[model samples]
Target: MVNLTRIYTRTGDAGSTRLSDMSVARKTDLRVEAYGHVDEANAVLGMAITSGGLREDVVAVLRAVSNELFDVGADLSNPLVAEPKWEPLRIPPESIDRLEAWCDEFSESLPDLVSFILPGGTPGAAYLHLARTVVRRAERAGWAAAEAYGLEVSAGDEPGGVNPLALTYLNRLSDLLFILGRVANEGVGDVLWVPGKDREPVGERARRQREKIEKAQDDLGRSS
Candidate 1:
């Protein structure tokens, strides 16, 4: 069970804050940036989920992603002042394995990538793709912070470093999101694949081609 408290504390009026260890720092600290990105990613994922039409499996994966993101945020919010009395948060390798498995399973259900896809399908799936891109950016920021921390440690300035596994998890998570977007819109009739300007317009040639492809897919779906 969890305890709930709603009392407001007016501690942030000075643009500074306390970490989990009760150490004070500016809100614009790199640690804050790292955690802020994780929070942004989580919010985007929430938007994707609420946009609707996601499969139960996809929702489950997103839920897991949300939980893991919170862990990432918690890990970033506190920098080691001294070797803490408690264990530091880390992204385990098993989390990466789960992401890979889910990506593979979802990708198996999608058609082979013949052309570069424009990210649109269902609204939920489209937002998932957008969130995936944002997650990649966040992962890059996290890695940069980790590298800086490593340099600090190497210089004998600190005793702790960023979790390598967390970076790996974010990398795999982006891949999983791409596959999920593809699978989520499978067989949905409104999928519109935009052609390059060099390609023919939506006249007889394009219409005929689209009809042939969609017909083949419809037949395949019915047969299956």
Candidate 2:
């Protein structure tokens, strides 16, 4: 329902921009930083969607998430107020539930994790990994904003705080992206972690480390 006739607005040339409510704030404002990270996360997801070789269902999920992230940005950009002239686009709790459901569904088929995963697999999955990290960063920024501006609305027309639901959405979204990244590696499998594998220790040190790792893995297998 909104239209932008011009992309270039001289208003921000002073290093300040207007929020969704048309209130001016500095470019370095915590709220602005939070929503800016959300925008970055969305763009990375776009890369994942178009990277090719992704499962159709996963693609559909990412597409939906991309749209939701925009709303998340809107929710962050428009600070919470006691009463607004118009209803703001806020992230809903149901959206977080949907992300949880997606995480569970996608995780169902992935192999049980015996070790940590590295962020590399198929090209599509690599992009998903990248997106996941970006989402995590966005979530952190949201928390920082929440810390700076409390999560509760205050009296009057002044913006009070950020939306807690929007923060939760970002948290859940990062998890979903991780699960989908694993799903994207359906054929290639996950790039698993090996503790100190890169160090390549030799002789007695290497022997001790290998023995301990083997014993731990054996214990894990028996317990599972």
Candidate 3:
């Protein structure tokens, strides 16, 4: 239970703040950096939720993730707890599993990719792509924070050590965002990149590609 009776506390008037463990740390601490990125990613998701052409289901998932980001920040802020019956909230396997499941579910309806894509589709998809990249930055920050504290990098789900599921959830969250971008675009119509097209003019590449397409069609017709 959180009770915020007073809004402004000048405790952090200086350049330092306290962690959930009541330990003093500078604003530039790695734990702060980690949670900062998580907050940033969540902000991006918030902006993305306002983009047009987003489905209700996709928005629902984003809203849920936005809430979980707070949990992630809290988990990072509290390094350790001495209380016997109380522990800081940590990311769980179920969260990571849900991300993976949603990613798989959305990807199943999408067409296979022949080439990498440019991060521009519908407005909603574009925002989701942006959020996906930010989430990746958050994941890297989490990893760095864990390593800096000498926490168990493999797996630790307690207050003192960085939980592997925290990193795993962020990783899977980006994956889910990437696929949800396509889902926002009706599960197709991704802006595909033309490999090696920058080496030559668009006119030249387009002519060649057109011929290749025609030739492929001809081959298919003959086989039929």
Candidate 4:
């Protein structure tokens, strides 16, 4: 089990951090960037979970995913060589398979998409869309890190490479989030985008922008 008795290590005061293996690296390393994006997606998902109006099923899946994302972070933090410690967590094929299964199960109930989906639906769906985009960015970061390292050639043969399934899991997670957006909308489905709807007069655009600005100010006022 992990212990956090000392919260202020101050080890990172020099803009460098230590990994699980006690090796030091810069804060801006690719591995750090990859895990940082995963943490961002996890935070967004957590916000989605705490908010009301989410379907019970959506909450259940996200709850499980929230846990697995930690595994993703752990896998990224610990680099693998020819042999890894028995206790270190590694994202396996089964984890990715579970995500694929969930996507398959949820997708069956959703209607086929005829138009592009805007990030507007229920409160849960909007947060899910935000999470999906963030996960895509995480996937890209993982790919860049993999390039800096190398892709898996054989089991534990690729030195210092991340678990390949971690990348696959993030890819499937974004797909599942898109499907969940449709599920959150229920019978209403996603808000379809009409291509030419925004080609109105400049005055109309200004009016919408003004409303957006007012809404932002009103939100700040409420918090204050």
Candidate 5:
């Protein structure tokens, strides 16, 4: 078990921080950027969990994601450092498979994708969608860092290049969020697909206007 000490060390006072290998780097290092993104993604997911009414199974999956993200962050913090004392922090291929499985499970419940749906749903679902997008950004940052370090081959070997599992997980996560949004809006009422009045073509505007009017009428009836 790691020791937990709250003693303040002013080591980072010069705008530099230490990595897992005890090497110091500027706070703006690429490794820092990558791991910071992971931390951001995890925090956003935590917010979604708090605000979204996720099913028990979904919550379980997200909990697993949180754990994986921590591992990813650790890997980013210490690249190519073979410290036998520190257990390997590789993201296994099975992790990607697990994300794929979850995506398949969630997608099964959603309607066939006939058209692109807008990204507004329940607040929790919307936040999940946002988190998914951020995760993609994080993956891209990781890939860039791998290329910069010329560790592409070794990194790619690890689940999704820098972290193949994370990439796969992010891709599936976006799909899951889209479906979750649909599920959240189901039977709560029809989702109004608002089109841009000024920018949209005439037919599109007319269709969206009709949808808006219908939704307004439904809302009035509910209030009455």
Candidate 6:
């Protein structure tokens, strides 16, 4: 039961903040950065949810992800200890499995990907793509934190490490967001990538001129 009597605590005004374990750490700490990115990704997910035009099923999935993101943040914020005074909220492996299942469910109808996709489509889908990228960043930050702290389960009265499953959850969430984006773009179709389509040769003359220059340079190098 968490209650926020006041929104502003002014304690972090000095560039320091407390972790879930009540230990003080700099605002730029890797652990702080991991959860901070998770918060950022969650905010983008909120934007996607409110952008409208999403189907009820998609909205339901986004809502669930938003709530689960809080759990991820809690897991990241609370430092692991060998023997904590109480059990802490940790990201469970089953969450990743759920994300995988969602990905499969949503992707089943999407057309085969011949080329890479550009992010734009429906408003909700664009936002989902943005959220997906942010989630990738969160995953990277979480891994960095894990590298810094190590992944040893705390046993006694000792400092514990970040949950590896939490990092995996971020990774799987990103994939699900991508599939959801495609689902949101149903009927409109995905904005497929056309490699060099925008940068095609100006003309045959221009292409020939460039090739001539390259050949001349190669020949000159060989002669020299």
TM-score of each: 0.78, 0.89, 0.82, 0.82, 0.75, 0.86
Displacement of the residue 42 alpha carbon in candidate 6, Å:
0.9
Better of 1 and 5 by TM-score: 1
Candidate 5 structure quality by residue, lDDT tens digits, 115-216: 345555466667776777788777777767766664543433242124345445555655665565555544343244444652354787676766655555
Question: Which regions of candidate 4 fall more than 4 Å away from where they truly are?
Answer: 152-159, 197-224
Model 6 lDDT tens row, 1-224? 99999999999999999988787889999999999999999999899988989999999999999999999999998878877767889988888899999988888766566557779868998999999999999999999989988788777655679988899999999999988887887746776654453235577866665565445434433432
TM-score of candidate 1 versus the correct structure, residues matched by position = 0.78
lDDT per residue (tens digit) for residues 92-211 in model 1: 778889889988887775665534555776798788888888889878887777766652222234635666677787889889988887766664632445454325545787776666
Best by lDDT: 6
Backbone Cα, N, C clashes tallied per candidate: 0, 0, 0, 0, 5, 2
Report the lDDT tens digits of candidate 4 across residue range 1-224. Answer: 78889989888999999766566878998888998999999999998888767889889999999999999988887776655555567788998898889999988866555457789657888899999999999999988988887765335544487767888989999999998877777734566664453334257775675555445434433432
lDDT of predicted model 4: 0.79
Q: Which stretches of candidate 5 lie over 4 Å from their true place?
A: 81-85, 152-175, 179-224
User: Comparing 4 and 5 by lDDT, which wins?
Assistant: 4
Q: Global lDDT of each model?
A: 0.73, 0.83, 0.77, 0.79, 0.65, 0.84
Lowest summed lDDT window (length 10), candidate 4: 215-224
Q: Evaluate residue 83 in candidate 4 and report its C-alpha lDDT on the 0 to 100 scale.
A: 56
Best by TM-score: 2
The C-alpha RMSD of each candidate to the native structure, in angstroms, is 4.0, 4.1, 5.6, 7.8, 5.4, 10.0
Clashing pairs in 5: 155-161, 156-161, 159-164, 160-163, 160-164
Cα deviation in Å at residue 170, candidate 6? 0.2
